[model samples]
Target: MVFRHENIRITIIAALYFAVAIAEVMCELYAYKPLIYVFKPLMPAMLMVLYFNTSRKRSALFFIVMTLSLITNVLFIPDSQDLLFYGLVVFLAHRILLLYYIIRLLKINDYIPAIIATIPFLLVYFYLFMITNGIPENSFVVLIFQNILISFICGIAFSHYVMQDSRRNSWLLQCGILFGALHFIVFVEKFYLTGFSPTIFRPMAMGLNAFAFYTFYEFVMATEKSHRDDARSIA
Candidate 1:
């Protein structure tokens, strides 16, 4: 009975998530600027609801990350440069907290593997730096720092997966971080680089972000379950 109830709950949440996501994409494609304000924030808000309903062991850190994400989403809805900067600042905090949360789950036994894993992420960061253009002087420093944080998150996630190939949680974390990095890269390209179509990139970024949040939630749940199992074994 409990399993059936959980399944039903997940199905409802998933339907709501897809509906909101599609609505947001339609708003973006049709240039319904005002409607975007309604659907855009709903994306993360739906995820937060899903987390609260589905998670057996909810981490406060993850809850805070989602709250910050919702705030950033609202901040980015406005066209003002000041709001954008503020959104970036809030998002930086989100990433920092997310990184710390992931680090707590990781057990680093070999520094060499971790160090080697960061090399590819560093290369990607440099490539993005070389390619992206027209970044405002004021926003440039924050953007750079944010990208570095993203790289570290991706690197740590990748290294964790490499070390724990058998764990599903590791895979979820890796995919989530990579999807998030890709979403941000697309965002930078759309806003800063020339000739990118907002029609194509906007929906794409939103979809990637949705996947990232879902996977992160799964990672948290899986890790929490593992922790419980470990405790039981010790007992």
Candidate 2:
């Protein structure tokens, strides 16, 4: 019965996600601000409901990430540069926390995979840097910083996924990285590139965020099950 309830809850949350995605597209089309507020917080709120467990470190960290995301979203709704700057700082902090949490399970022995993962990061970074060299000083710095940070995260994610024996967490992490790439594209479009980025990318970026939360939940479950199995063996 609990399992059934969990599945039902997951289904409902997924449905809501799809609805929010539609609303996102419509909001872009119509320039609706209310829809932004309604859906911006829904992802994290539902993430907490789906993954919250007092005993799990990943759960708590993810909750913090999402809470910060919600706050940042609210701050971005205003036109003030100061508010946006503060939001970026919080967002960067969230990324650092997330990076720490994901890397916690990794060990020094994982260096091979980690090094291999950096190839793509270097490739993407050089390509973007070459193309956007003409951007303004302050904006260029922010764009470069964001790109580097995201690339580093993606590199770590890919490397960790490669070294996993079960491959379950690895695939989830990889998928999350894929979505993260989409979000990166959105960031580039919004900050560096000119012209209207299609509203369609909005939901695509959010979809990546949903994938990240789900990946964390799965990691927590995997860790808890391993602990339980270890306890049984000891008994």
Candidate 3:
């Protein structure tokens, strides 16, 4: 009965996650500004719930990350430059914490692979940099810093996955990082670049963000399971 109850809980959470994700996308597509405000923050809130429900062992670091993410979402809702800069600052701290967490699990003996993995991200950053014009100076600085940080995260995640290709947790972390980087790129193009259509890129960014958070949650669960297996083998 405990097992059954757990399964039921997971099912409900999964259903709600999908529903919230779809509503978020629809709000973007239809230009429902009011509903967008309602659903945007809910995205991270649902992720928090999903993590709480599915994780066998929860870490305070993960909860802190999700809470900051929620705050970032709220900060970005306004169309003011001051709020956007503040949002970027909060997000920078969020990424720094995430970087610390990922570094704790680093097992790479060689840095060559990680350096090579960063090339793609560098190229993307270059493209975005060349195309972006008329953005506020402060926002531009923060955006560049954020992109560089994300590139490092993606490179480290890729190298980690290469080292442990057979591990599901490694793959989950890799996907989550890649999805997050892509979402950030799309967001920049839609909001900062000229001649970009929000109708197309907005929903795309939102969907990618949703998937990234979901995979991050999965990565946490998979990592816990991997640790358990290692402990069992040692015993």
Best by lDDT: 3
Of 1 and 2, the candidate ahead on lDDT is 1
- The alpha-carbon deviation from the true structure for residue 169 of candidate 1, after best TM-score superposition, in angstroms, is 3.8
Per-model TM-score versus the true fold: 0.87, 0.76, 0.88
Candidate 2 TM-score to native:
0.76
Q: Report lDDT (CA) for all predictions.
A: 0.73, 0.62, 0.75
Q: What digit string (tens of lDDT, one per residue) describes model 3 on residues 1-235?
A: 9999998998899789879989998988887889988888898888788888887777888888888888987787666778978988898888888767655544346778777887798778767776767767787777777777787778777766766775654655666475656646555753555365556666777777778877777776777777789889999
Candidate 2 segments exceeding 4 Å error: 53-58, 76-82, 106-109, 133-143, 165-167, 227-235
* Clash number by candidate, in order: 0, 0, 0
Q: Write one digit per residue (lDDT tens) for candidate 2, span 1-235.
A: 9878877877786666557655655664565778777766675676666565323444566678768767766665544556656766677676677667556544245556766776687677658666653344544556556566667667766666666656445654664476457646656555545355665665566555556556665665565566667779999
Cα lDDT over the full model 1: 0.73
User: Per-residue lDDT tens digits of candidate 1, residues 1-235?
Assistant: 9999998998899789888988887776676889888888888888878878887776788778888988887887666778887888898888788777877765445567656766777677667776777666777777777767777777667767766764655666566565646646555644555465556666666667767777777777777778889899999
Tell me, by TM-score, which candidate is best.
3
**Ten contiguous residues minimizing lDDT sum, candidate 2:** 50-59
Q: Stretches of candidate 1 above 4 Å error?
A: 107-112, 177-184, 194-197
